[model samples]
Target: MNKKYVLFAILPFALSACQSFPTHLKKNEAMIVETQSPDLLQTLSDYTWIYQSSEKLPPIVLDLDAQKRIFIKTGCNNLMGAWQFDGKQINTAPLAATQMLCPPEFMAQEHTAFQFFNQAQLNASINISNPVHPLLTLENKAGQKITFKGEIKPEAKYKSTGEVVFLEVSPNKKPCPTDNTQQCLQVKQVKYDKQGIQTQIDQSWQVLPVEIQGYQHNTKQSKIIRVKRFNTKPQTATPEYAYIYDMTIEEEVAPQK
Candidate 1:
């Protein structure tokens, strides 16, 4: 028996074992690195996400601000909080929300979502493997997962902050100031308190004939709605304020023609 031959036989086994362990470990490390990249955060920041887990509830919308703060809309109420991402792990601060009363179903959905986000060691992953439709996934310690589909928010596309306000739209469409032949919805600004009480209402009405981005007016009724107003650059000839309908507050029959 030669010592050199025995050493070579054992050497192959040691090398095989050494390689197997790291290869297994590298696969996991790569998976973690893939999700923790800053690009993932940038992808998330580019669009507002709509929660797709529940059909009965209104889609939840999220906007990440410049300061790393998150603004959330759970269909009926708004919430604000700080969020941070550290190597595939997602963490959130205590969230503050408006005290709006909503249906029991929506309230329950909101609470469940809040708990999911506050989980200490939640994991986040994005599926951009498909370009046309990107998905965001968040998984809690209990293995429960919430998924969201992304939609470009106005601020992301327009490159400006939108002023969020509420407007009461008149039932009757009055003659447009610019073009009398075309009738318009007489809109007035309305304000609400933290408790969702109507704090102030504008007495004067202004004619708005153009289509608002997120608002759909029903000719059969008048409505009080929340809207986002974006300001255009002064250099452009476009109208100063661009309005998008957010949500309807009150609905009533149209006034007699």
Candidate 2:
């Protein structure tokens, strides 16, 4: 795949920070005396990490262990995989995947995801100070860094309003395949016209910046592909609704290999 296309497809978890070391580190000698080393595998087994990928409208949490067991919940689908954790490395292979087929944009994401875990090296660690979150660093053989801040949650609820939203397609500007045609990113704006209540909804899409077939092609063009059904609705106190809409941003840029 073209590097640009590959990048577009590969990024899902692409975006954290603070410098304070844990208190134990401050008292290194005391910590060493009191803290016994925990087995890495045992410490991370069955732990979950929140993941944000380009394909899904919302982030997801991934759960896996040494038993070759795995599970994940994207905003739209529940997925499964098989995992392996040798003393020094971890590997994951997706098992049977469902065919709900999210939007075209999300479809690209699904493909990207399969490509990601099919064969990748993963490093897992914990935040001793905050057990609720686990840190994961995924890297290719080249030692390039693909890291993120992930949260552990047993369940994720989804909310959706019967509505349409806009998304920004990246790689801001480029030349179209045809003469005199230009390709650029587009931002979508969605709202409930009935009440005139508007919400700027962020979305996922498989964008194609190509020229129109056979016309003068005066205007540079880009394709807009809607990915999945997202909960663009504002948060509420009650969870009575089946789905909720959320508009959030996750940029795509990682340490290069």
Candidate 3:
């Protein structure tokens, strides 16, 4: 085994998980941006707005009441901060947030709101006429933008389905690994259901696993299986045709030039 391969295997554990929010923006001078619709902005200012990401968790709600009090739900715990809105500027000073540690997922949501609040150069528009849906348009310091169509919905119920998948797994090249024999393998996807109803998994979509191992065998018995390398020519198959079942386990021989 090459010394380079041994060092490469140890590199995965070296990654550190840390998150920081930027809180250095100055607030000496007042700033405001004109909105296309004034009534929309007013309707937005009146109610507490919640932001829910695609993550499978509870929503993060931010309540901006009168008297400059800002209360936010960090998925698990509530955090309080000082906020002042002059004209259209919704300025939130650095929060004296609570030190309660929820799951890491909730912490990520808190960080997202912190960054969005800190970088608001202008508040464009907010329309909340429909109680179920609201529209918020925000602009950052660089004049780049994003539009969020907010909706309040109930949590979705999920279930487990017993279906197998044929999956092809490969380590990313460019930074090649030391294992020359072990490259990539395809496997069948495990089935899942929602609320006892079978869910549809997109065709050709792969579930990425952590390990570089190709064929997954039962631990009760030992088996030897050959697997293809990552850089092999990928065969493209259309959804209209039949689904390929066999995972290529050997080097595909090239034709004569």
Misplaced by over 4 Å in model 2 are 1-38, 54-56, 76-78, 123-129, 142-144, 148-257
Candidate 2 lDDT tens digits, 1-257: 01122112222221101112233233344234224433555445535566676553666556664344565555545556555554334555434455576777666655555555554555544554555555666665555544445543222223222334323334344544343366633334333333333334445433333322122211223322233343333475532212112222223442233
The best-first sequence of candidates by TM-score reads 1, 2, 3
The models' CA-based lDDT, in order, is 0.67, 0.43, 0.42
- Scanning candidate 3 in windows of ten residues, the lowest lDDT window is 1-10
What are the clashing pairs of model 3?
A: 165-187, 165-188, 165-189, 166-187, 166-188, 167-186, 167-187, 167-188, 168-186
Candidate 3 — which residues are off by over 4 angstroms? 1-42, 118-122, 128-132, 142-257
lDDT, model 1, position 232? 61
Better of 1 and 3 by lDDT: 1
Q: After superposition, how far is residue 220 of candidate 2 from its true place, in Å?
A: 44
Give the residue spans of candidate 1 off by over 4 A.
1-39, 75-79, 97-102, 129-133, 163-168, 174-209, 216-226, 231-235, 238-241, 246-257
Error of 1 at 174 (Å): 6.6
lDDT of 3 by residue, 206-255 (tens): 33322333344332321212222231122545211112222322222223
